[model samples]
Target: MDNTANPAFDVTKRLRATSPKSVAIHEEAARVMAAEIVGTVEIACPVYIESASGSRLTDVDGKEYIDLTMGFGPHVLGHRPASVEKALAEQITRGWHWGIHNPLQHRLGELLLEAAPCGEQVVFCNTGTEATMYAIRAARAFTGKSVVAVFDGSYHGVHDYALLVAERSSDRRNPAPRRRGAGIPSEILETVAMLPYNDEAAFDIIRENRDRLAAVLVEPVQSSNPRTDIGPWLRELAKVCREAGVLLIVDEVITGFRLAYGGGQEYFDVDADLATYGKALGGGLPIGAVAGRTDVMSVFNTGSERARPIFSGGTFSGNPLTMAAGIAALTEMRDTPDLYPRLNGLGDRLAEAINRHARQHKMPVTMMNAGSMFHLRFAEGQIRSSRDITSRYVKAEHVFYQHLQECGVLVPGIHLAFVSAAHSEADIDAVAAAVTASLDTLRNDGMI
Candidate 1:
């Protein structure tokens, strides 16, 4: 463990325990999870949701919350959406799993291809983690390079390569891959090269490793706390990957569909060799997909001798129920012509309002946004790379979240939030007001 990250505050020591439903559930989780799991020690505000609807949640204590977490950005159409609900109903009437190819998977795949401009072929999977794992393997098979590079602070689920984070040092010379947890093998980290997100130096990193690099995977935008738009950098990444003969893979698991119907590709205006999607595309079901140009994607084509070793065998890969839900979700996002612009406007308003409130109250916090994606950072400088997101960014007056939760609003697990098509002007206003209230209370207590 790095002493730099082991700041006095990031280390969590409970002052006391309680019997609240949220506390009880967390206690149980602590008991079941290994001590090595960060969740077992580090803590956040409470949430014991009993039920959720469009953009709102009700906890077991009967308190309502305007849900900005949106189940980690998956419920873009909002929780328990009628379209997905109806689709699940239809699937229930038909069947669950058949352990073979089904029509629904074919239909959803076609739908994904149609929505996906850079995509010529598609492969279904159960989760974003699986989608990324297979996509990297596919890129390696096609390009014959053993190494892949992912940006720092970019979340790519649980994978050996993406688990690495940049070393906590300002000097470029000190940069090294730091493992996420203790058990990840050093050999695995050796295969991966870490780059600072949105840094111009990415060109240097890729150029230096061009011979060994199979792919350069990136999130078009790092939407975690303090959302930073990486549009121009994405264009550069696309250009470099083509010139270097290294495949570019966009890990759009979080940004897909929420930002635009076609995901990060549509927003960034640069085509990657492959893109992975899960969150909003699944429409509340457990689904993920990797799509790419036929040349690179054909490695997965059935009956191809070259494709035999690139295995992605998940029993729930193309389950009918999940396909049904995805079909409905994609259709909703596509059919509604105005949803994209409308959600973007609301997100803009939310960011603007939150920033205004934070500034007026002398809180050194800033909210940023890209379409419906938004997050806050406590740092005052320009956030360009993953290294820029320091402890000051996350270790803000978290009592704001606690107060917001009390006042019926839910942000992300950290300093993040998302807007959905289900969010309306009133909903946005309510969240804005909650932000003001939370800040006001903090200011009164001399905490801001």
Candidate 2:
């Protein structure tokens, strides 16, 4: 094989000259920062972004690229949307942070409750991690149960209980829980159960563990394995949870607002006892919340005697800046009836075009999407669940994304991409073209 044909080698050479500023910045940081920070696949190019606006990003080196990550699911309205920006600017003048009560929280909470099917009340927090942690705590306190069940391939947050993966050697239908990373105690394994995604066998597990289970947390669309045909499965899961007397906590961190105004609850037509939200909720700002039935959420209320009050507070939980942004974003989305339809249509068209191209050329790649959320899979077959994925084309997959970057398109390290309302038809066209060119380049180089 010719060395020049390797995309990684070519990418390195091109970036070194065109992105000298970014390379220098990365070098400086590498000397002081932890090795793990600078070595992630997400930052593969060391291309530091200088500014972003409306589906495009400019790097410090003055090169521009179309951004598909969309702030990893937060910037659904695109970066620096006028309404959110205006709200933030005005909020800054009034003092962005105050440790006291502010009327902004009331309006934001009202908007959330109105949109979320299960949301009667909301509790604010700093990030999705905190929101899930608090939701789990409340579920346990409310039910007096010791266990929380999570599905395989579902990512909730960085908390100890949320960082579980199914043991690879265990049975696919009945998998054992394993810690994803270090620092998580082995004892946490006892408090959590891992279930297969998109499988009816999970229903049996829920029933068997009903006595000890407090809540069954799930992501409507798994980030690692996105699919559009999971509505039936989700609806059935909700029914099972109800039958077993276990609370269902849908982790809408990635799907909230992006799928629809009501998030996964409306998209999948399922109700939850408790639902956690983040990502798009704050209009590109850092925020998280748990919204649920009044009875279950009342566990946070000290005045309620139904259950012991669970401690939930944060210094910046309901900061005025985030509240202003959330209200502005939600208000625009609610008023604009056609926004979701247009966004979802764009997603459908993009997926169709790329998948058609792959089929016509016999490429072993598939673009799976759920509304605007997308994931590029290396295999070309029906993917019912994350366990069906194979790592045979891992090297080619990395090279394909590198080639995409060379063509002025950007996707995150995990290959989970999203489209926003700000992405025009022309923008989608360009993305489709870039994907085709990348696949062709990979084929020519004998990488795919």
On lDDT, the leading prediction is 2
Please give the CA lDDT of all the candidate structures.
Answer: 0.77, 0.89
At residue 139, candidate 1 shows an lDDT of 91
lDDT of 1 at 359: 74
For candidate 1, what is the total of clashing residue pairs?
A: 0
- Give the winner by TM-score: 2
lDDT of 2 by residue, 1-448 (tens): 8868556778667767777898888889879877644233453567778999999999898889999988888988888899999999999999989979899998999999998999999999989999999999999998999899999889999899999998778999998889998999999999999999999999999999899999999998899888878889899999999999999999998988989999988999997999999989988888999999988899999988864599989999999999999999999989999989999988888899899999999989889998899998889588877877888898888778877887898888767899998899999999999999889888887877
Cα lDDT of model 1 by residue, 337-413, tens digit: 99888988899998899888877766767777887888766656665654655564343355556566656677765
State the lDDT at 184 in candidate 2.
100
TM-score between model 1 and native: 0.90
For residue 108, give model 2's deviation from the true position in Å.
0.3
Q: Give per-candidate clash totals.
A: 0, 0
